[model samples]
Target: MENHFMKRSFLTLPLVIALTTSAAISQSLPPDDHQNVASLQSAADQGNSDAQLKLGIMYFNGQEVPQNEAKAAEWFQKSADQGDENAQKALKALFR
Candidate 1:
């Protein structure tokens, strides 16, 4: 059981780091950089899995957006539905 959890953590750590970094970068963007942020949101809206995951991370951490677990779950679910393993794992972690 412990090993299973560890493996799950190991697999998810990278994804978490990547997503968090992406969200952080977005948050740090200047107001004039709304184009990039808009582009990212547009990608997520168009069903880009990584973009969805990044938005999920952003919502989860209150980065560019407010912290909203429900919104985070929604974005994570969208990414997971697209067969993103990292998003699937992220959703699981969010639920737990």
Candidate 2:
């Protein structure tokens, strides 16, 4: 019985380690993409130029938000109006 227990323990060790490692990795990753985009959108709506620029980039690249040049341009324009140089450049590029 003791030998059988030892064999079982050894067999379970790797499985235990793999599960622990997976949990840790998952915890370290960023939150859900939708949640992130929603938070960014909220901030942008509140007139945060940086958030607007980031949201614009996300929309432009379809990263979380749908790919919509119109939405991206709108967000970029909002940031540009607030004197965000990056957003200004992006807006110009989008229009060009």
Candidate 3:
């Protein structure tokens, strides 16, 4: 039982820290930036790696959009494929 608990804690600690950090970052955004979200989404859809990273953060944090880990991972992968270092780190932290 102790080993199982330790394993679970180890597995979840990174995810918890990622979510917490993402939430803090999201909360720091301005209130009137709704349009920014749309623009970011548009850029992300257009294969802008920076936008993809931002969208991943937003989705991961449940900021302007609903929180979705799968969606976050998808966005991160796109940016990572484009050679975005931040996105690569985010993906590693998320999946590791």
The top-ranked prediction according to TM-score is: 3
Each prediction's number of clashing residue pairs: 0, 0, 0
Summarize candidate 1's per-residue lDDT along 1-96 as a digit string, tens digits: 999899878776765776677666766999786545478799999989988888788788877678898998999999999999878878776655
- What are the lDDT figures for the candidates, one per model? 0.80, 0.72, 0.81
Over the stretch 33-95, how does candidate 3's per-residue lDDT look in tens digits? 434788898999999997898788888878788999999999999999999877777787677
> Residue 5 CA error for candidate 3 (Å)?
6.0
- RMSD, model 1, all Cα superposed? 4.6
Over 4 Å off in model 1, which ranges?
A: 1-35
- TM-scores, each model vs. reference: 0.65, 0.64, 0.70
Clashing pairs in 3: none
Greater TM-score among 1 and 2 belongs to 1
Off by over 4 Å in 3: 1-35
Tell me the spans in candidate 2 whose CA falls farther than 4 Å from its real position: 1-35
All models, RMSD in angstroms: 4.6, 18.0, 2.8
Answer with 2 or 3, whichever has the higher TM-score. 3
Candidate 1 total steric clashes: 0
- Ten contiguous residues with the weakest lDDT in model 1: 14-23
**Which has the better lDDT: candidate 2, or candidate 3?**
3
